[model samples]
Target: MALTIAGCTAPPVVAPPEPPSAPNTSADLSGIKSYLLEKTGQLKQATRALKETSDRYYALAKEANFDYTALFATQKDEVIGLIQTAREQWMVASPLYEQMEGIVAGTPSLAEFDMIMDAGASKEEDPQDPAPIDVTLPDGRVLERPGNLFGVTESTLWGTFEAFRVPGQFDFNGDGQIAFGESLPDANVLKGGVDALDEQAGELAEAARAWTPTESDAFTALVVMVPTMSEYFDSWKNSRFVSGEASTQRDFVAISRLADIQDILSSLLVVHDNISPMIRGVDTAQDDAIRRGLRDLKAFVAGVHKQESGGKRFKPEEADVLGKEAQDRADAITGQIAQMAARLGVKIEQ
Candidate 1:
């Protein structure tokens, strides 16, 4: 009987039930982490896409001889809209992902959650150019050229429009003010009128040369002429039916003039983007160095643009000063651009 009692089986070993799963707790937290990282990457890609698209649109607008401000404005709105949409989606998804992580780890306080997820939103609208409108003629077809500059001035086409509006008689008859009449005179007479026109054009050109844009309004008007100056080169080059080669004997003149205006515009835009980064504490000493380099480059390009175009008639001694200034600026900017390009892996000709 003792032996039988000893043989009795021991009580079955008890196993505890598995612990309850925490709400949204990932085993390794890798899933949620990966998702947040991917979302951030997507946001950056969207920003890059927006920039590429904008650059293309701007380049095309400039090529078409469109009004720069209006062209820029049109592209800017589209870019801003795209950025807003991407940001909204990123903001919504990012915080939610972080929240899930917090829940899985431990219940985080609201303030702590905000601290982890909050990069406060910034609100500002991008400035841009307005949509372009085509100018239609009597036959409902767009006019390729409006002789005497009537069609250009009639529309919002950019340039020194005031030149077209001056009151003057076509001949010695001393008629009343010559308004921008609807129709051009017959082409047969056009050749005969060249001498008088040449004289008038010379006077107008002298006025353009002498005019110094002193006030903001005058500067704006001058700035607006930049695209037209560039377009003059295009028109001279492309019109095969016209005397293209003879027209561009002074081709460099047009390029130099347009370059000056573009240099100014580039400087203004750069100051807004890169220079401000240095000033705002967004970046530090390296940024300050880059900013100084950019400033020097900008000044040089401005001088080159002015001198090349013969925009300002400088004395020989002044020309040397201007030349040195331009060279210095160009060198500085080229160096800065090279440094930046190396960091970003961008390839551009100096």
Candidate 2:
């Protein structure tokens, strides 16, 4: 045969095998649905507490003819306690509400949810700026509201309203300084805010119960949420927290924002745990990376609590380093999550 070969045999021309497709990790839709339901229940309970407390305060204020001094004399401690309770409940409910947005994106109710619960305007210099409180529904019906419930309530409770400047209005803490724990100057406005919050809470609960998340929706929720953690941290770094605006008084803004970020990260971890098996199957190293990143970010946040200046909160200069570190760690976690999403063939929407 060798002798008979007249020319060199041509090399076998085999088409290159198509590259293997990335592994598709099945989304934990059941887990997402259950978690959303659980959070919805918690939100309902928390909002109920808020509404009840607010109602009691409003009733007492009404009985007193909105006389702050009279109300303070009679039920100062009770009013203060209710305000504190409402604020605490709000803190718990707010983050869960945020998580629900990601889980229920692309649904019909999302627009309504945003309209009712959006916190974008909460931190504005003047959250009470007059705007159209009427919303045009999908059916073209007008839905009138007094104002944004959370923002209005926060402004009133925190004494950001001009009316709060009235002397002898709310001095619950007796420090002579009207601060967050004080009562609202106008009982009517506070009542309106409470009613709106209660209504919105009902709507949210209804929407959550009706929601049915698909596997794709679960994946979207996981992918979309990772980057939001950075947004929270960035807000802290670029806002009053870094510019020394929060150094003077007991600025709860920074603390509130930090707590919000922590809540978001913790929620993401819950979702991660729900899909841990799939993530492990795709790449254990990436999973480990994400876990480590989250741990580091949490540790950094914890360190910040120990760095408080003037026994109020960490000063701008003191927080600068830790804030940057937190942002970096959040970015790392986001990157790892993005990689995992890509491997799972989940398209992440901006």
Candidate 3:
């Protein structure tokens, strides 16, 4: 009836509809979440160690009736030992935080801790970007937004700020000469600062556990974090690590800023790796170029680190040159990521 010698209108022949294809879900960023949690757990453990050692120090000081001189006179080795232990814990906690900072600083909900822990200046130092928390000591002395926890602890332990130090210098190391960080820290201040840091670290760890990362977070982290080389280099230029004995900075003396830069970039690299598939899906050539550029940037920093390890102290002037070069590379890479994010409709959080 449908093909009646072309004299009648042909009945329509309909093909069945095909099933819908599955969603791409190309960027499975669960690894980023896992990485953050794993590192946060490790950071919490390190902070706990610092807290324990700090408490032990404070307990000994209390036993000495708040006389640090008396405490050091009678228990020099224990005091030094506790201080060293706290320092070791700080070393661990710092890099662990750096490893998580790409995610932490990029996410809106997680960004405050980055301010309180790492990048925020003191109210006095930078009212615009000051860390808004204050520390209270046992003696009722209040540090009015004295800076980021890391800065507070570092300055307190190193005796860079006079208010955070005990009355006089001590040859705690028995080297016959008092060097940097050789003086007795005011125990009350030490305990307060480290305790605050430990508390905040614990909070950050919990927050990180609760955070579910998205492609936005990964891409935003790359865009927001990858171009920070200039600031880090400025810190390195001003720090004693590069400025030598003439440096007057209160913080960043205990560790090289170069090392910190590498740690931070290493975290951003993790963020990129987790989202590379999405980038590749959008533009394979661009993804490969970004990957290569990032690796090269990191390798450039690594080259500087290797030189530092070999005792090649970079002049402060040289840091400017290096910083500019690194920043240029970083800016280029970030631009690619930003363009790709736009193409993929990934919203980079402001």
Q: Which numbered prediction scores highest in lDDT against the true structure?
A: 3
The per-model lDDT (C-alpha) reads 0.32, 0.60, 0.85
The residue pairs found clashing in candidate 3 are: none
Question: In candidate 3, how many Å is residue 313 off?
Answer: 1.1
Using TM-score as the yardstick, the better of models 2 and 3 is 3
Cα lDDT tens digits for candidate 1, 8-54: 97998999998975332111323323433443444334334433433
User: Could you give me the TM-score of model 3 versus the true structure?
Assistant: 0.92
| lDDT tens readout by residue for model 3, 93-207 | 8888887887888788899998898878899889777997888887788988899999898888878888888886589768789887887777899888988888898898888
Measured over all alpha carbons after superposition, the RMSD of each candidate to the real structure, in angstroms, is: 24.9, 7.0, 3.2
Instruction: Give the lDDT ranking, best first.
Output: 3, 2, 1
Worst 10 residues of 2 by lDDT: 246-255
Instruction: Compose the digit string of candidate 2's lDDT tens values, residues 1-350.
Output: 77568567778899999999866466555676677678778777877777777778777776777677777788878777766776676666666665555554323334345545543332233355433254332223443543455656655555555542235556666788855445453555555665666677777777767777654454455556555645555455554445444432222342356655565556566666766677787898888887777667766665554453334555555556666666667667777777777877766554
Q: Residue 29: error of model 3 in Å?
A: 1.2
Clashes of each: 5, 0, 0
Q: Per-residue error at 170 for model 2, in Å?
A: 3.6
Clashing pairs in 2: none
TM-score of each: 0.26, 0.71, 0.92
